[model samples]
Target: MTILIGCAHGTRDEQGQETIHRLVEDIRTALPGKEVREAYVDVHGPFVADVVAEVAAEESCSAVVVPLLLAGGYHVYHDIGEAVKDRADVVAAPALGPDPRLIDIVMDRIREAHIPDTATLILAAAGSSDPRSQADTEAAAEMLRARWSGPVRIGYAAGIHPTVDDAVADARANGEDFEVAVASFLLAPGFFQKRLTESGADHVTEPLAPHPRLVEIVLDRYRDAGGS
Candidate 1:
């Protein structure tokens, strides 16, 4: 059987850790006989390189690394890419965002916050210097805009201009009478989510993990990379 390695950018937050762990467990449950494991690209281990190396050494087993990240960035292109580059038995899948189903989860979060119809929505993401990552985030914002009636904007928690605070501030200045709501485009609760909450928006939506749809997305990505 092929192995599915769910690799996430590790977090220091305990709840964040639990959320990611639960996500991996759900993936395992979804694919009963397949071997599923967890690895990280940053902040903690088992790091992606080590995990891939170990899996590649095993007999009769190929591995697919599915990034739990919302978008492809430095970690995906450099870290995960480097880990699997030399190994014929290992391949890496795309990051999880820019998917319509994820937008569905974001919309649900916005509704749960009871955001007003007049509220301006800001899609908040953990930014990256990589142009590909920025493009992925923009695609996600466009997806959200298609379903949302209100105006949609993009903001970052770090790494690029127009921070969440700046986005919230601009929304308030341009549409003073309208409420500003931030829809977190993050995967789990952690530093980035906290930044969104503190970005001065009238409301902030929750992160988009610990959901069944996410598990489905992971499975699809694994299959797309030729994993069994």
Candidate 2:
């Protein structure tokens, strides 16, 4: 039997870990016969490599590593790829964020905010030091902007420039009378989301946790990973 491994960035926050754990459970139930497991890339326990090694040894099966992350950042390229190396059995799926369905989540957040046309929208990501990661974030932002009517700007909490504050400032400079609605492009409540909130955005939407559609997306990744 092939193992469906859901890999997350991991956080010290117990609540955050619990949320991801629950997501994995949802995926497991979606494929009752498959052996599903969870792992983290950092901070939390059961690292991806360890989980891969454990499942490969136990089931004598290859695995697919589906990132719970939002985009094809460093975790997808360097960390996850390196961890799965030498294990010909493992295949990594696309990041969770760029999935077309994500636009629905983002749109919902915006609509839920009751954001006014006068308000400028700021899509905030956790941000990565990796240029490729930022590029992916920008790509998502562009997709969102194309569909959104209001002024939208892409910003990060850490890594690259134009942080949440910077995005707000840019919007204000553009004479947007910026409300700076923060559309958190994260999967769960974590440090980055908290920091973005504290950064003084006028409005901040919660992360995309416990979303029913997300469960469907995860299952698709698992099946596409070659799970039977």
Candidate 3:
């Protein structure tokens, strides 16, 4: 049987871990009778290598690993890719990002934050050092700009230039009426989400996870991967 492995960039936050597990549970619930398991790429246990090895050992047990990340970078092209590379039974799915539906969620969260049209919108992502991740984020920001008429800017939480605080500060400095609001590009809450709240933006939206649409995205990735 082929199992669904929901692999995420793990977090040290206890609640973050719980939220991730809950998301995985929801994924399992969505695809009833399918065995969905959880693993991490960093910060916590059940690492991808071990998980894939375990599944590969079971006779005829194939698996699909769906990345819980919103963007592709080192984790996607290297870490997770390396874990499943030599194993034919393990087919790794694409990252969950650069999707229109995710932009929908960001807009939803922005509206939920109650920011007006005149305000400056900031697309805040937990950044990566990889240039590819930056390109991916820029593409996402372009998608967001397509929907919002006001100025949109990209900010990072870590490992990249223009931190969230700097972005928020710049937006605030634009003019007297500048109302800076941030649309979180993160999948789930953790250290970076907390940083966003402290970034001094007038308003900040919640993370993308704990939403039904994300579960749909994960399943879509899994199905798209096709069983081995």
Candidate 4:
């Protein structure tokens, strides 16, 4: 059977690590009798390249590296891409975002935060220098806007323009009468999540993992890349 490598941008936060581990376990449970493993593109390891090389060496075994990241960026195009590019038996799947179900999770988080309809919403992501990543984030914001009647804006935790702090400040300035809520576009708790919490918004939603829809997305990505 083909192996499913659930690769994530690793984190130092223990809870973040646990959250990602749980996601891999869920994928394993969802695809019984198949080999499922976890790898990382940064912070910690077994790193993606090492994992992919190992899988490639195994006879009769091909693998799909499904990014647990919310958007495509350096990690997706460089790290994960380089890991599988040399091996015919290993292929990489697309990042998980710009999907309706993830927007549903973001909306769920917004509602759980008790954010009012009048609140200006900022979709805050861990930014990347990659334009593709920025475009993916913008697409996600558009999706959120369609479902939400309130104003929606985009912000970044790092590596791009209009930091979350700035986004929140701008929203507060433009809509003095309205509260500013940040919808975290992150996958799990970590440094970025902490940054979002301190972004000066009236409220900030939780990260988008530990959700069943995420597991479904990972599975779909794996299958889309030709994983059995």
RMSD of each: 0.8, 1.6, 1.3, 0.8
- lDDT score at residue 18, model 1, on the 0-100 scale: 98
Look at candidate 4 and give me any clashing residue pairs: none
- Model 4: weakest 10-residue lDDT segment is 170-179
State TM-scores per candidate.
Answer: 0.98, 0.93, 0.96, 0.98
Q: Which residues of candidate 3, in runs, are more than 4 Å off?
A: none
Candidate 2 regions exceeding 4 Å error are none
Q: What is the Cα-based lDDT of residue 194 in candidate 4?
A: 99
Report the error of model 3 at residue 77, Å. Answer: 1.1
Candidate 1 lDDT tens digits, 1-104? 68999999999999999999999999999999999999999999999999999998899989999999999989999999999997999999999877998998
By TM-score, how accurate is candidate 3?
0.96
1 or 2, which is superior by lDDT? Answer: 1
Measured by TM-score, how close is model 1 to the native structure?
0.98
Give per-residue CA lDDT, model 3, range 115-168, as digits (tens): 898888889999999888888889899999999989999999988879999988
* lDDT of every model, 2 decimals: 0.93, 0.81, 0.90, 0.93
